[model samples]
Target: MADLSTDIALDDERIVRALEEDIIFGRLAPGARLTEDSLLSRFPVTRHFVRQALVQLEQMGIVVRERNKGATVRSLDPEEVQQIYAVRELVQRQAALLIPLPAPQALVDQLLAIHKEHGEHIESGYLRGVHETNDRFHLTLFGACGNKYLVQTIELYMRYSLPVRANSMADRAALDISHSQHRLMIEMLQGRDNWVLAQLCVDHLQPSKRRYIDLVGH
Candidate 1:
């Protein structure tokens, strides 16, 4: 393969990250073809590394590979979205149930820090920062789930879902409302009531998904 970069600036991880980000942000739409040659000739990575990243995404249920049809990103429908969240909540609820409550106050503290930072971003009208910071909040909470696979799965889901969230939260007023609701979710987790925490998680998803369905539906 001809070197795609003069200085070999494109590494395997960098290429994968770039592709993943594009997919996450919906620049690469679902069902869009991803050819190895086009990418390899364009990027400096070997076919092996590209395949590896694609396989990882497949495991996370975001990318699909068909024998003859080729590989493309998954197109998630409303029912599929509901199923993903329902299963996620089930697993996370159990994870929360088992995560010794007091032992992870540090997670709550991290969410607090993220919340404070997000508030500033909100005021500045940089809505994307709020979305990223919100990821940090949930990342902290769920990262300590003690279930490595579950945590990883959730992160992958979040990456792909972010564009959906960012689009809906484009309104500053709605972003502010969302921030307040997320803050309440963090507080709810402090109680050690796994059930309530699970419900809070489900409820938190409602506002954004509702906006997406409404906005995108029309």
Candidate 2:
């Protein structure tokens, strides 16, 4: 029974991740209804699993559930986008600033490897791969801050702004810019200028924030 329960839990998690990617990649547009019937037809899971997945998404800030409305992809207004991005910028910059100058060779090598995978995904036009690796690269970079709480805050804001950030994932030019920026970040890590690295981290977040605000109109 324990093995069976574990398998069910893993299956539920898989559903949650797939739905998350759908929302993040714009396949599931903001405000689209996530009906249980629809989800059941899509995944070979029970209604209970669908409900659990939706609850997890809600906790992640990727979905909103209302009494009569069921679940919908969470949409942020311009003001909300601005606020979330502001926090994200602050936390991410602070995390970068905390990293030891001339980052350890191990850290540099790790980031390089992730960056390489990110570039390959972009070249192959694999949107899922690109999104996953891009996230992995950023999280790994920020994790070096050596402050778990700060890194957790940075990650939280990243989750909150997913709808706003999704636009960039589908834009070719934006992806290229991100790819270049990741390479620059890796190079910056090998240097001793913490301020420059910190500023770069803040600057890296602007395009998506600006683009989202413009699209939604303040």
Q: Pick the candidate with the highest TM-score.
A: 2
Candidate 2 residue-wise lDDT at 108: 95
* lDDT per residue (tens digit) for residues 91-145 in model 2: 9988999999899999999999999999899888899899889889999999999
Q: Candidate 1 residues 1-218, lDDT tens each? A: 67655323445457656666666555777667888877788766678777776776666556788898777877656666666666666665665565555545777777888999999988886655766787787767776667888777777767555535645555777777778977886777666676776676767667766665665455
Error of 1 at 165 (Å): 4.8
Q: Native-vs-model 1 lDDT?
A: 0.68
After superposition, the stretches of candidate 2 with alpha carbons farther than 4 Å from their true spots are none
Assess each prediction's global lDDT (C-alpha) against the native. Answer: 0.68, 0.91
Prediction 1 TM-score vs. true = 0.69
lDDT of 1 at 100: 53
Clash count list over all predictions = 0, 0
